[model samples]
Each structure stands twice: as C-alpha cells, then as structure tokens.
Target: MTSFRQSDRLRNVRYDVRGPILTEAMRLEAEGHDVLRLNLGNMHPFGLEARPEIVDAVAAGLAPAQAYSDSRGIPEAREAVAEHYRRCGIDDVSADDVFLGNGVSELITLTLQALVNPGDEILVPAPDYPTWTGAVNLTGGVPVHYLADEANGWNPSIEDIESKVTPRTRALVMINPNNPTGAVYSEETVRGIADIARRHDLILLSDEIYEELVFGDARHHHAARTAGDDVLCLTFGGLSKAYRVCGYRAGWVVATGPLHRAADLLEGVTLLSNMRVCPNVSGQYAIPVALGAGAPGSPLPADIVDPDGSLERRLALTADALNAIPGVTCVPPRGALYCFPRIDREMFGVADDEAFVLDLLHTEHILVTHGTGFNWPEPDHFRIVCLPDEHVLTRAVASIGDYLARRRR
Candidate 1:
C-alpha cells in the first residue's frame, strides 16, 4: 500500500484564526463553555441584519435564478457593478468588463490563477488579508511582503513597494480600508501606489470590499480610478462586508484602463469565469438592488439605517473598548469591522504575539489572530473583529487588559 500525502501548496496555508483555535473554540462552545469569539469577521451573530429590500429582491428573482445565468454573471448584476464603480470615479468600465463570482474570495483565486505564472512575484502588504498571500501561493506565484507603515496610519509605503518590485513582479495587491488594520488609504497613498504600478508596468489589484464602511471623515480612495491609463487595474468588491451579506457570496471584479494591454489576461480570466458557470444566481439577482439601495443619492430603505446600524455601533464600541486597554494601542479604525492593535511586549512581558494570543484565548476565553497570520514579521500585534456587541467587546477588551496586567506582574 502506498502512503498518501498532501500537496506542497498546503504547506504555508495554516489559517491561525479559524484553523486550530476556532476548532477548539467551537468545541468549547458546544460543550457550553463561555467563549467570546473575537476571531473571525463574521457579523450575522452580532445582530447585523441584511437589508429587507435585498431580501425582497432575492425572493423576487428566485424563478429566474432557478435557471442558469450568464457565465460572467447576470446582465443586471454586472451593469449594477459597473455603475457602482462609475460612481467611484472609475471611468469607461462597462458591464462586459465585470466578472462576478461566489465572493471576493473566489474572484481573487480566479484572478491569480489567470494572471500569475509559476515563480512570478506579486507585491502584497504585510499585515494584509491572509487570503491574498494564500491565493498567490496556491497559484504558484511568490507573494512579496511590502510594508504598510504602522507609523503612517498603516498606509502602504510607496518607497517600500518600489524596493520590493523585481523583474518578475507581475502585480501589486492593495486592500483599501485594509482588513485587520482597518486603515483607509488616502488619495495621496493611492496615487503613489498607482504611480509605482505604472512605472513598473505591474497589474494593480485593489480590494475595496469595505468601501462603504468608512468611519467619520475617512475616505476610501479607489486605486483603479487613480491609476487611469498608466496601469492595468482590477478593483474587487462585494456585498459581504458593507451590506452584511457575506452568506450571499456575491462579488465582482472590474477591469479598468487599457483593455488591449491586458487582453490576454482578461481572456484567461473570462475562461476561468466561464469554467465556474456563473456565481450564485440568487446572489446575482440581489446585486443590482444592493448596489442601487446602497448607492449615494438613491433612496435607501429606512430600516437599512434604522437603530443606528449595527456596524456603526460596533465600530464605536470596539474603538472605545480597545482604547481603554493598557499596552494595547489601536488606531481608530477608519473603516472595516476590525482593529489591529499593537501590543507593547515590554509592558506585557509577552515573548511574541502568537504566544500572547494563545495565552489570551486560554486564560480569557477570547480568540484573536496574531499579526503573523497577516504575514507581519514581528509578533507584537493581533487583530480582533469588532463584530461582537458593545458589552461583549467591552468585556473582551477588559479581559485582555486583565491578562496583560497579570503578565506584567
């Protein structure tokens, strides 16, 4: 008998948040242990409700969704996506240029498979959404970690990006209103990255899923719009985060700039999209309504904004609670439902972030992802999802504070 083995692609793919810790957390919860799940960015359990209009739209389209739609996506959804980008100042994008998938997660894999060749390199931010690194690795591409300067509000450092680019570097991945860090890229930073991509003739992959979730005065600058004709850009967005519709799995990518330069790449992407035979049809049906309802100047149903909206309240609670913790300094998240706080190792007497996170989990029943999970080299940080309720987050932070105090003692 021959022994079987997993592929090398699975080697670097440990999901620290949902891998072992979450399994234990789930088991503990099953056995009725009081575990505060601050790990994943899931919102459903936190009272974030889907818009009723979106629900109605999905229900109304059930008949059509029962049949297969276009491989790229239903025409209406694609059009709505194009319009959504147009509203963001991205010009000349048509529905034909949009490709929909199960989620931004699915579309990212497809894009990487289409664009990346074996051993090719792509620039990704340290402390990024781990999926980007995983996708690059799975596609047989090397992911180069570029710094998003913590000193600079976690914005991608243009100088660092330029230094990392090599002859084999094919693209740069930018997660605006970045996951974990929740730092919204400023217009200057966006333009700087766009300029770098243009200079090096690299594809720009902008993940803007949290575009609509910006907190007071913080703006999400669309990198694709900033790049213009100089560089080929693909902006990926979805209804998951902002709309509280992660289960819908509706996501789309828009190809902006000169199509001729990326004709082969787009052709490959289209082939991948066709291979999937379209995203969930019911989810596709809801895209137009989701985009339209959420669009500025469009009449959003009252309930969508009623009771102060779960996300707004959640952000406030998280910001307030995280700020109160000793040796845990977090930048007020400008967007997204996360806060990545830097842990003062000296103050806490913690050896590394993974150890700190594990200690917190075991001692406080609070789960979190260490900075290393986001590909950060140092282990003095961790990310906590702000989706939990005010009381829960407050208690969780308090527990962390207690843990830190004990470590110091």
Candidate 2:
C-alpha cells in the first residue's frame, strides 16, 4: 500500500501560527485544562467585535449575496476600496484597479501564484506575518529575508534590503504596523523600500491590513503612493484587523503605478480569482459601508472596549509588563496588536524556541508563538497578542515572568 501525501508544492510551506503548538494546546484543552491563548490576534475571542452598523450592512445584503458576485468583487465594494485609497492620497485609483478576495491572506497567495515561477526570489521581512513566507514557498519561490532592525524599533534595515536584491528578485513585501513585531514603518523607511523596488524594477507588494490600527503618533504610509507612478505596486488591505471582522474574510488588493506595464500579471490574478468564483458575498456588502463616505469615524468597537483606549491600554500594559521581567525586554509596539519580546537565551537556558514555548504551554498553561515560527532567524523571542483585557493581559504576562524566573533558577 502506498501512503497518501500532500502535494510537492506544499513541501516547504508552514503556517506555524496554527501549527504544532496549537495542536498541543488543543490536546491540553481536551484534558480539561484551562489555557490562556495569547498567540493569535483574533479579536472576537477576546471580546472585540465588529461595529454594529457593519454587522447590520452584512445582514441586509444576505439575500442579494446568495448568488456569486463578479470574480474581481462586487462593484460597490471594489469602488469603495478604490475611493478609500484615493482619500489616503493615492489619487489615481479607480474601481478597475481593485481585486477583492477572502481576506489579505487569500490575496497574498493569489498574488504570489500569479507572480512567482520556480526559483524566483521575493524579499520578505524577517519576523513577517508567516503567511507571506509560506505562500511564497507554496509558489516555489525563494523568500529572501531582510532584517527589521530591532535596535531601531524593528524598522526594516534599508541597507540589508539593498544588499539582498538580485536579478531573480521579483517583488518586495512591506507590512506596516507589522504583525508579530507590531512596528509601523516610518515614512522614510517605507519610501526607502519603495526606492529600492524602483531601482531594481521589482513589483511592490504592500500589506496594509493593519493600516488603521496604529497607536500613538504612528501613521501608516501607503507604499503605492510612495511607489508612485513608476513602480508597479499591489497594495493589500482588509477589514480583518481594524474592523474586527476577521471571520468575514473581506479584503482588497489595489494595483497602482504603471499598470499598463503589468497587464499580463494582473490577467493571471484575474484568472486565479475566477477559479475561486468569488469571495464571501455577504462580507462584500460590509466593504461599501465600512469605507464609504458615511463610514464611522473609527470602525473599532469603542463602546464595548472603553471608548477607543482599550487596545492602546492593553498593548501598553503588555509591553510594560514584559519589559519589567528580569531577562526580557520588549520594544514597545507602536501599532498593531502584539508584542514581540526578546528573552535572554543564556539566562533562560533556551536553546530551541519551539521547545521553550512548549515548556511554557505545559508549565504556565499559556500559549504564545515562538519568534522562529515567524521566520526570525533567532530562537530568543516570542510573540503574544495584546487583545485580552487589562486584567487578563497583566495576569498572563505575570505568569510568563514567573515561568522565566523558574527557568533561571
């Protein structure tokens, strides 16, 4: 008898956010152990939910959404995306430039499938969202990592990115208010990356899914705007993070900057989109309402989450707590919903981060993703989501500190 195996394309692919650690966590749950999941940035599980108006819009469109929409997206939703970007200062966008999908995750896979051939290289940030690296591998493309300098608040090192470019490099990926690390790229950093892409003549793949989730003085700079009318850019945005609608799976990728040159690639994306028929239709209905002229000042559930300060307060508490630990230091997250904290490998006796996290699961009953799982080349860090309330977050971090103290002893 022959063993059934997954396709060769899946050989190098790994989405560790839901991989083995999650499996073990599930096993523990089956044994009736209560687990604190600080790993995923999923909002609803932590009592963060979509705005009522957005939910109402989805419900109202359910009847019309029973049928499949145009492969690209519902016209209103596509136009809403285009208009949203136009207001963001990418003035040339129109509905024709937008391609909607079932969240930015799907768009990432689709864009890579259309762009990469075997052996092509794509510049992905070290400590990326992981899905980007996995999707590139699934497409048989080589993912070249450029360091996001932790010494400089985890901004992408422009020099490192420049040194990694080669003739085979096809595209450059930028994640603002980045996941895992939660460092929003500065305007200079964003433009420097766009300049490198321009010089190399590479397509720019900007993931702005957390665009609206910035904290403090942090502001998101659109890569497409920086890529300008010269470099071809695919700007990916979605309702998942900012709108607390992860389950809706609504996202859009806007093509800008010399679109006339990339007609062939866009055609491939359209072909792939058609193969999937369409994204969730009812979710599409929320887009126009979420981004249209009359959209709420802020899409977050302020009423439920302490009048807009809840996320900021939680992230601040988590970072502060982590920094207070003896052998740990967390670069305060300026945006997004996580804190990527670095631990002293020597002090903690940590050789393998995965093993360290597994031990944490067993001893502390808390689940956080190891840094290496996000494709960081080091075993000294781990990411914890900051969506939990103040009390829960403080307790979880305290548990982590207690666990680390034991490791030192």
Candidate 3:
C-alpha cells in the first residue's frame, strides 16, 4: 500500500505553535503525565469562560442559523464589524467593506489568495505567527521576512522593510502587538510602516487580533487609521483573543483607507467568500451583541483584559519571574498573552532551540514553542504563552529555571 503524501504547496507552510513539540507534549500526557501546556495562548483552559451576553445572544439567534447567511456574512454582523472599526478611527468602513469568517485564519488565507500571484513578494515581520507565512506560500507568493529588531522593542525596522521591497512586492503584512514578541507598535512606528506601504504602493495587511490585549504603556495604533487615506488596507481582528471565545470561530476583516482603488481585488475576495457559502452561521449570530457595546467613551467587556487593571497583574508578575532566571532575559510583553525570552546560547551551550524546548518539556513537563518555530533565524529564543494562572506561570517558569540550570552543567 502507498502512503498518502501532502501537496508540494504545503512544503513551506509551518505552524510550530502546535507543531512537533506540542505533539510530544500530547504523547507524554497520554502516557499519564500531567503536562503544563504553555505552548498555545488558549484562554478557556486557564479559567476564562464565555461571557453571558455572547452566549445568550447567540442562543436567541439560533433559529435563523439553520440557513446560510449572505456570502459576506449576515448584514448585522458585517455592520457590527464595520462599526467597531469606525470607532477605532477607520471611519470609511461600512457593512459592505467588512467580510466575516470563521476566524482571522480564514480571512487571511482568502485575502492572500485574492491578492497574490506566483512569485509575488509579501514583506512580513520576523518572529511572526506562522500562519501569515503559510498563507502567502499557499497562495503561491513569496514571504520576505523583514527583521523586527529585538533591541527596538521588537518593532519592525523600517530600514529592513524598505530595503527588501522589489517591483514584485505586492503587500506588507503587519502583526500589531505581534505574536511571538508582544511589542506593541508605538504611534511613530506605525506611521513609519504606513509611509513605506504608501511609497511602494503595497497593499497593507494588518493583523490586529491582539489589539485589545495591550499591557503597560505599549501603545497600539489601528493600522487602518495609521495607513493614511490613500493606501489600501485590510485590518483583521476577531472574538478569539478579545472575547476569549476562540472556539466560537467568530472573526472579520474590514477594508479601509483608499480601498476604492482595488475594485478588482475586493471583488476577488467576495467571490472567494461566496465559494465558502458563508462562515459558521452560529458564530455569525453573536456579533451584534458582542460588538453592540457603545463607542469609544463607553466601556465594554473587552476593556477588562487591558493592561494595568485586568490581566496586567498576572502579566507583570510573569515577566518578572522569567527575567529573574540567569542568562534568560525577556522583555516584559507590552501586549498579548505571551513572553518571547532570549536564551544566552553560550551559557547553556545548546545551539538548537527546538531541542532545548523538548529537553525542557521532558525534564520539566512544561511545553513551550521555540523561536525558530516562529521563523527566527537564530536559536536563541523561545515563546511561552502567558495565559496560565499566576500560580501556574510561576511553577512553569520556575521549572524552566531549574532545567536551564541543569543545562548549564
């Protein structure tokens, strides 16, 4: 019998957040060991529950969900997404400019599919969520990684991004409040990136999924607002991170700025959206109530996780704990539920981060993602999800410290 093989297109696609190391962690758990999973930023396992309003609203709309919604999404959900962005300062958006999907994951693939042709270049940040890289490759485009300088608070180096642009470059993907590195882009940084996009005539793809999860003084500018009025920008965000409803698969993409120029691209996106028939209908039902919370001055449940008041207490404590380990220094994440810490390779004499991660898992029973897994060129860093409880984070990092000490021997 012949074994089934994956397509050649999947060769460059990688999502190491749940890749090999996670598979090993699962194997250990099945053998009956209690593994502390810090590999993924999943909220529910850490005690977050779906809010009452979101649940009730979806339940109330369950009847209509039996039928397919409009290909772009039911009008109510699209309007809610549009209104959310409008409040964020992207005033040009309307229901027609918004497209709903199961999650930002689907929208990202669709957006890339519509825009990229074979060999087209897409400038993306280093140390990014692998999905962005995977999407570009799957769409037959090349992902050109531009360094996001760690020394500069993990902000994208404008010089690096600009230097990589070629005539074939079609777009720039910005993951604000970045995944592996939680550095939120300051206002100046956001504008600088937008200026590059405008000068090069590149479509701006902004992933703002973690926009609502900022910590400390880390400022995040809405990419749509910062991209200027003449640039075409698609900003993607969803209920996964903000509302702690990753399982609900409710997410959206909003077109903004001078998007009218890309009439053909937007139509391509719509046709693809229709190819899927519609996103999860049940997921579509929860949008209005979830987003109905009034404008800027009005408080919404999303604000609870913002820095200083909500998860700040845990984030602050976790950052301190990780940095306390000798030769392990982590920039306290300004936003998002992750800590990407640099490991002094000379201190441990381990050159492969993936091996280091697996050794830590086997010895400490704590799972983490390696930096190379997120496409870091060096083996000097690893990503740890900070979504666990205060005590869990404490124990997990302490285990890592002990494991590091052993590696030093």
* Candidate 2 vs. true structure, TM-score: 0.97
TM-score, predicted candidate 1 vs. hidden true structure: 0.95
RMSD of 1: 2.2
Sliding window of 10 residues with minimal summed lDDT for model 3: 301-310
lDDT of 2 by residue, 1-409 (tens): 9999899989778888898999999999999999999888888998898768789999999999999999999999998898888888999899999999999999999999999999999999999999999999999999999989899999999999999999999999989979888899889999999999999999999998888888788878989887789999999998888788899999999999998999999999999999999999999999887775445565432233234688988999999999999999999998889999999999999999999999999999999999999999999999999998899889999999999999999
TM per candidate comes to: 0.95, 0.97, 0.96
Per-residue alpha-carbon lDDT of candidate 1 for residues 1-409, written as tens digits (9 for 90 to 100): 9889999887776567676777777777888878888887766777777778788989899898998888999988999998878866787889999999999999999999999999999999998899899999998899999988888888877899999999999999999989989899889999999999999999999999888888777877888888887688999999887777888899999998888888999999989988988889998877888888345676532234324766667776776777787777887787888888888878887677777787787788888888898998888888989887677777788888888888888
Candidate 2, poorest ten consecutive residues by summed lDDT: 298-307
Per-residue lDDT, model 3, residue 299, is 52
Best by lDDT: 2
Evaluate model 3: give its TM-score.
Answer: 0.96
Report the backbone clash tally of model 3.
0
Q: Give each model's whole-structure lDDT.
A: 0.85, 0.91, 0.87
Q: Could you give candidate 3's per-residue lDDT for residues 340-384 as a string of tens digits? A: 999999999978999999998899889999999888899999998
